[model samples]
Target: MKDILVRSLTGVVFIALIIVGLTWNVWSAIAVMGLFVGLGLAEFYRIFQKENEGPERFTGITGGVLLFSGLCLTWLSWADQRIIWIPAVLGALPFVVMITELFRSKNNPIQNVSLSLFSWFYIVLPLFVLILLRGKANFPFEAIFPIGMLLIVWTNDTFAFLSGKFFGKTPLFPRLSPKKTWEGTVGGLLFSLLAGYLISYFSGLDLTFWLIAALIVAPAAIIGDLFESMMKRSLNIKDSGNILPGHGGILDRFDATFFAAPLFLILHFIYF
Candidate 1:
C-alpha cells in the first residue's frame, strides 16, 4: 500500500513536470529537457563505467547539454541566426572526447570514445527532435503537439498495464519483458485511439493525425521500453538510476518519449 502510494504520487509529479516544461515557455522547455538529457546521459555513462576504463561522463554530459539546448534554442529561433552558431560548437566535441581519452590511458580507448559519442546520438538527438516537434511553425504559445503526443503515449502505457494484469495470456515478448502481453497491447492501442479522439474533440486538431499518431506511438513506445529493458539486462543492472524514487530514472520514465517523439515529428513534417 505504501509503495503504491509512493508510485502514484511520483507518477503524478512526473507528469506535471513534463506538461509544465513543455507548455509554460521556451526557457522552461529548454530547462526541463536539458535536465533530462543531462541526467539521462549521466546515468547512461555511470551504468557502463568501468574501474580501469569507462565513458567520459563529464565531457559526455556537458556536450549533450550544449547540443540539446543549442538545437532547442535554434529551433525556437529565440536568438536569431547568431545563436545558430551555438549548435555548431558541438562539432568539436567528438574530437574533444577522443583527445581526452588519450590522457586517461583507459583499458579500452575505443570503448570510451565510442560510448561517449553514442550518448549524443541516442539520448540527446531524440529530445531535440521533440523540441522541434513542439516548435512547429505558427501554432502560437500552445504546445498542442507535444502535449497530445504524450497524452496518447501515457494512455497507452496505463491501459496496457491494467489490461495485462487482468487479461494477459499470450506473451508479447517474454524474453525482453515478461509482463507484457498481446491482450495488453491491443487494449493499449484501443485506448490510445480513444485518447486521440478526445484530444481531437477538445483541441480541435485533426482527428486523422491524432489517430495515426496513436498507432505509431503505441508500437514505438513498446519497442522503446523493450529496447531499454534489453540494455539494462545486458548491463546487469536493475534500473537506470534512483533519481525518480519509485519510478526509477529519467531514462526509465521517458523511454517511450525517446522513440515516440522522433517518429511523430516525421509524421508532422510529412503531414504539414
Candidate 2:
C-alpha cells in the first residue's frame, strides 16, 4: 500500500514537472531535458562500469550535454544552425574513447568503445529529437506537440500496466519481458489512440495526425521498454538505478520516450 502511494505521488510530481517545464518556455524545456540527458547517461554509464571500467564517464557526459544543448539551441533558433557542427565535432567522441582506452591498458577496448558510442545513440539522440519536434515551424502549438507525445506515451504505459494486471495471460515477449502480455499491449494501443484524439482536439491538430502519432508511439514505446528490459536482463540487475524512489531511474521512467520521440519527429515531418 505504502509502495503504491509513493509510486503514485512520484508519478504525479514527475508529470507535473514535465508539464511545467514544457509549457514554461523553450529554454525551460531544454533545461529539463538536458538534466534528464545528464542523469540518464550517468545511470547508463554506471551500469556499464559495473561489468568493466568502460570509457571515460566525464567525456561521455560532456559530449552528450554538448550534443543535446547544441541541438536544442539550433532547433529553437536561439543559436545559428551552424552550431550543429558542435555536435558533429563531438561525434568524434568514439575515437577519443578508443584513444583514451589505449593509455589505460584496459582489456576489452572493443566493448568499452562500443558502449561509449552506443550510449550516445541509445540515450542522447532520442532526447535530441524532442528538440527537433518542438522547433518544427509548421507544427501548430510547439509546446503542445511534445507534451501531447508524452501524454500518449503515458497513457499507453498506464493502460498497459492496468490491463496486464487484470487480464494478462499470454506473454507479449516472454524472452525479454515476462510480464508483458499481448492483452496489455493491445489495451495500451487503444488507450493511446483515445488519448491522442483528445490531445489533437485540444491542440487544434487534425485527429488523424494524433491517431498516427499514437500508432507510432505506442508500439515504439513497447519496443523501447522491451529493449531496456533486455539490457537489464543482460546486466543481471533489476532496475537501472535507484534514482526515483519507486520508478527506478530516469531510464526506467523514460525508456518509452527514447523510442517514441524519434519516430514521432520523423512522422511529424512526413505526415504532419
Candidate 3:
C-alpha cells in the first residue's frame, strides 16, 4: 500500500513537471528537456558501468547536449542555419569516443565507443524529436502538441494497467515482460485511440491526425516498454536506475516518449 502511494505521487509530480515544461515558454522547454537528456545519458552510460569498459561519461554527455541544442537551433531558425558549429561538434564526438578508449587501455574499446554513439541515437535523438513536435504546426493550441502527445501515452499506460489487473488472461510476451498481457495491450490501444480521436474536440488538432498518432503511439509505447525491459534483463538488473523512487529512472518514465517522438516528427512534417 505504501509503495502504491509513493508510485502514484511520483507519477503525479513527474507529469506535472513535464506539463509545465511544455506549457511554459520555449527556453523552458529546451532547459527542461535538456536536463532530462543529460541525466538520462548518465543513467544509460552507468548501465554498462566498468572502469575502462564503460562508455566515456563526460564526452558522451557533452556530445548529447550539443546534439540536442544544435538540432533545436536548426529547428528554431534563431541562428544562422549554415552555422558551422554543429558540424564541428558532430565531427569531434566520434574522435572523442575513440581517444577516450585509447587512454583507458580498455579491452572492449569497441564496446565503449559504440555505446557512446548508440547512446546519442537511443537517448538523445528521441528527446530532440519531442522539441520538434512542439512546433506550431497549424494547431491553434500550440500547447496541445506536446501536452496531447503526453496525454495519449499516459492514458494508454493508465488504462492498460487497469485492464490488465481486472481482465488479463494471456501474456503479451512472457519472454521480455512477464506481467504484460494481450488484454492490457489491446485495452491501452483502444483507450489511447479514443483519447486521440476525442482530442480534436478540445484542441485545434485534426481528428484524423490525432487518431493516427494514437495508433502509432500506443503500440510504440508498448514496444518502448518491452525494449527497455529487454535492456534491463540483458544487463541482469531490475529497474534502469533508482533515480525516480518507485518509477525507476528517467528512461522508465519516458520510454514511451523515446519511441513516439520520431514517428510524431514524421507526422508533423507530413502535415506541414
Among the numbered candidates, top lDDT falls to 1
Q: Which candidate has the highest TM-score of all?
A: 1
State which candidate, 2 or 3, has the greater lDDT: 2
lDDT values, one for every candidate:
0.85, 0.85, 0.83
Q: Write the per-residue lDDT of candidate 2 for residues 104-151, one digit (tens) a residue.
A: 777777887788788889888887777666664533367787889999
**Which ranges in model 2 have alpha carbons more than 4 Å from their true place?**
76-88, 136-140
lDDT of 1 by residue, 44-81 (tens): 99889866458888888888888787677677775586
lDDT of 3 by residue, 1-272 (tens): 99999998888988888778766767667778899999999899888885546777888888888888887876776457576566677778778778878888777779889989998998888887777666634332566777788899899988998899899999999999998999999999999989997787777568899998899889988888899999889999888888888889998888887888788778868976
Model 1 stretches with alpha carbons more than 4 Å out:
78-81, 136-141
Task: Evaluate residue 124 in candidate 3 and report its C-alpha lDDT on the 0 to 100 scale.
Answer: 88
As for TM-score, the candidate ahead, 1 or 2, is: 1
Say which prediction, candidate 1 or candidate 3, comes out ahead on TM-score: 1
What lDDT is obtained when candidate 3 is compared to the true structure? 0.83
